[model samples]
Target: MSSPVPPQHARPKRAMAVVWASAAFVAVSAAVIIVHLAGAPSGAVEPSSYAASNAAPGAPQTVAVGPSSSPAAKPSATSPSAAVTKTAAAPPQEPPKAGWIPVDQAAWQAQVAAFKARKIDPVPAGVGNLPEFRADCQYSHRLADDPIVFPDMPGASHMHSFVGNKAVDAHTKAGDLTKFTATTCKPVVDHSAYWVPTLYDAASGKPVETTGFRVYYRSVRNNSTGIMPIPTGLRMIAGDAKKKVPTPRGAQGQFYCAFYGPGDLDGIARSTNGNWPICGGDATLHFMLQFPDCWDGKHLDSPNHKDHVAYGSDKGCPADHPVRIPALTFDIQYGVKGTTQGYYLSSDTTGRSASSMHGDAFLMWDSDAMNKRTKDCIAQRRTCDNNGYLH
Candidate 1:
């Protein structure tokens, strides 16, 4: 009977074989999982590595994770094992050299190249008649600092009222302004820093800070032709800080009265010293200072800080300062009404005259923005407000 077909038990043997095979597969999968857990890379960064330990108190806490903050870089296409090559960063720039310093050749060349490439647009039809653009700024801070005059020496200079760039300090340079983009001025692209000697209340001997400050960039001459943009890193001082002369009612560069409508620019009453104006009826103290509109096309600054610029004539700029630039005017208004007791300037503590009133401008701008405004508004002889828009 063919040995009774091996006792007819094939089903039991097949079941045992299937059980053994399933056990072996489970063991292999477990081994694989253990290996992966032991050898896999951990991508967690150390907590201290990303901490903003150096941030100042009350400042926004910011961590600099560098390029890794972006999407993870992919491997090189040419060689999968190789990392993607990073672009070399530009070299660190030096802090701008101040008095008696010449402009950096490379930086000047780059600015000139960009300025030359800028488009010179014609005056648009129905443009306003004023050849001016303005930067309206609020008072930023008060410090015993003058960056242009007393750089790198904190508290060495007299008290000054600063506007425009909020980061300006005694150690600040033109290049520093760009790095600190927080500013008090509108159209924040104008990173320029402006400062004037602090005004003081004569009666109380307390500070009298500016209530309103407007910086006007314009052409003094009727003809705006051949006007080049103000060079980057230019330092200018408008009035004579050392002057202590009497500013009578009709004296030039004297502080005058400015009101809304139908009022005399000269005040109705004079100070006890006849140096300052006592305004009446809805008027306050106002002072307007105009800077030179001509540049030498050479030095960024000189020992005197005034040699690199010159006043322009009705015809054009002088030969010495052949390059024509937009004149900067500080239209400052004080909130306190003038009194017969008068006011004192930080520069003229003894004399207490407005004659010593002066201003300093350290210019830094977004090159493209400045070029556009110069071409579209200033060169075109159009009036533009804080936003560089015609009213």
Candidate 2:
């Protein structure tokens, strides 16, 4: 009993030791749990990985596409609903073909504006000592859904739209075609037929149309080029029928443009199929083809239609094609409000090639008109039209 009384202070020390041992065991267990979590499989995660903040919320997330120069593709709240929404960077304009001119956008626009502003009356004013004679022809019909060279065959030739002469067909003759017939041209003297490709809707696989069409025949010569009539049986091709002939930039005779729509005049500017303005909407795509002024009297048609005809220069006609005639011009207009899918040429029978993209003219002028044109208007070097004598 005396020994127990003496050990009272010692009892407190033993109890304190037990408490320290329990605290150490609990600390070891917590560290093991931390290590286990750090090396755990995919599902387990450490608490430190995420923020445990109880503060206010921050900014929202945003996605930036590229460097600052290029704008974001999405349309803004204030932008036009019909505007072309940029989805990606635009590809560079195609490289101009060799010997081909590039399209001069600004110059083209200015020229188009000027043409639109021109005041052309049904009757024209004449110049003193110069009789004005022009063949202002409008759109009429398909010259040949088949070609004159190969008629009655489905796949042999390209399709062409014809105007001026009403009797044109796959086997029309100069003598017969020249017979006096009603025409869409002014002065009623132009019985000759003009032809080009007919436009088809790129989307619906149907035909497209034009409300306006006019062609002008004139002398655009620099030197005193002698004038002559288009030989009785002349058959020729203008523009490239085979090659992807690149038109030179700023050239007047051959041109490309957008009209009567949005900025692209509402047509396709760069289409997948290389049509400059791929029309998916309300704009119209246009092309103007100018023909040669010099000719070789002996040959009416060439194996290559272009070989017999030559363009005039400042000096005069070339030796090969010396007979000069008024340069033929086809001002073609099409109503194609298209989209960006692609476009097909009126002459395009083969979907893969632009070889069919061409124009053709068959010489069948009314005898009186031809005679008067060669003698008075062309021979006199005066500018003329179907409306009346114009300077």
Candidate 3:
């Protein structure tokens, strides 16, 4: 110690060196802190992977960034502002795609007015007698779908034989019909769709589809006055699909034999179960279903799918259903002489008879064609063929 006391300047130099080292250490620590700040967001908690994925499209994510570490600085799990933002970002709930929904009154009324503007005249006297027009269709496809009854729900119904409007299915809507022009029916103007329960041979469990399907639009009453054209989206169902009672030879609405030449309309013999007819000679099995001719002038459809329509009497339509429309008839024919084991409709849960045979019709036609045909053929009491021309 005594020897060091002789060099005071040397002691000062050593002290200066210690100060420089301290400054360097402080500078290096500051640089490290700056680099960390630049790399990542400050005061941000990592967001959950699920929350990021489930955020509504185009919705802004809430991110908190600040120096404070207090709970108030963070977003609350159930904050009112957050709830409002989420609700606003979500899309509105949509109504069911298909059902017995009400028709657009304003739109339908516009269609009615437009139809009335199209003027048409009656045919010459004695040119035709019956008030009818027809659409001849071939079988297009078969499926367990019913657009009228079980719309928007695929495979919800029993198997059905379809005709007209080839693209029809359980998802079909009334307005979507015209877009599909490819149809099985002639007179391409008729874009309507029809379906019936599939007929299956009970013996072999095989399907027997329709050989010919003729849809006849006619005036049931002799008085054709006030017979307005069928509404564009009219849907009607004929016969009760749930009717399980035996359809004997004499039963009403039973299948019968049809032929061009001499033969009984009820067939010469009956099936083993007496539900179906055994055609004789050149005849074939045929079923005729007639829908109502009067409408309520309000609903395009009803809860039961038949309440909006009513059968008019010989005099005129009823008071409730005042609007008179064409009576729709499904004249369906099936080839095959008659099997001993008979046949069963797809809707026949009883596995016994053809009493469950029923028909569904969804009407769609070119507005001009429908209005003209209704005026010239139906209103005039004249028969029109498949081409909507007098024969």
For model 2, how does the per-residue alpha-carbon lDDT over 1-391 read when each residue is reduced to its tens digit? 0010110001112112111111111112222223332342111111111110000011121111111111242223233213121221211243112221122346434433443344443333433222224554555544223333443332233445566665555445455454435565555666666776655555554444444444445555433345555554566667554444322222222223433222332233555554444533333455545567677655666555566777665467888877677666554555544445444554443452333445677765654456555555545544444533433
Off by over 4 Å in 2: 1-132, 143-147, 151-155, 244-255, 258-268, 272-274, 278-283, 349-356, 374-381
lDDT score, candidate 1, position 249? 77
lDDT of each: 0.63, 0.43, 0.62
Return the clash pairs for model 3, or none: none
Listed in order, each prediction's TM-score against the native is: 0.73, 0.56, 0.72
Per-residue lDDT over 104-163 for candidate 1, one digit per residue giving the tens place of the 0 to 100 score: 778777876887788766554544645667687777766566777766655556667887
Worst 10 residues of 1 by lDDT: 45-54
Candidate 3 local lDDT, 300-345, one digit each (tens): 8887787888766667888999989887767676877687777888
Candidate with better lDDT, 1 vs 3: 1
Give candidate 3's total backbone clashes.
0
Q: How many backbone collisions does model 2 have? A: 23
TM-score, structure 1 vs. true: 0.73
Model 3 Cα shift for residue 262 (angstroms) = 3.0
lDDT of 3 at 106: 84
How big is the positional error of residue 25 in model 3, measured in Å on the Cα after superposition?
Answer: 99
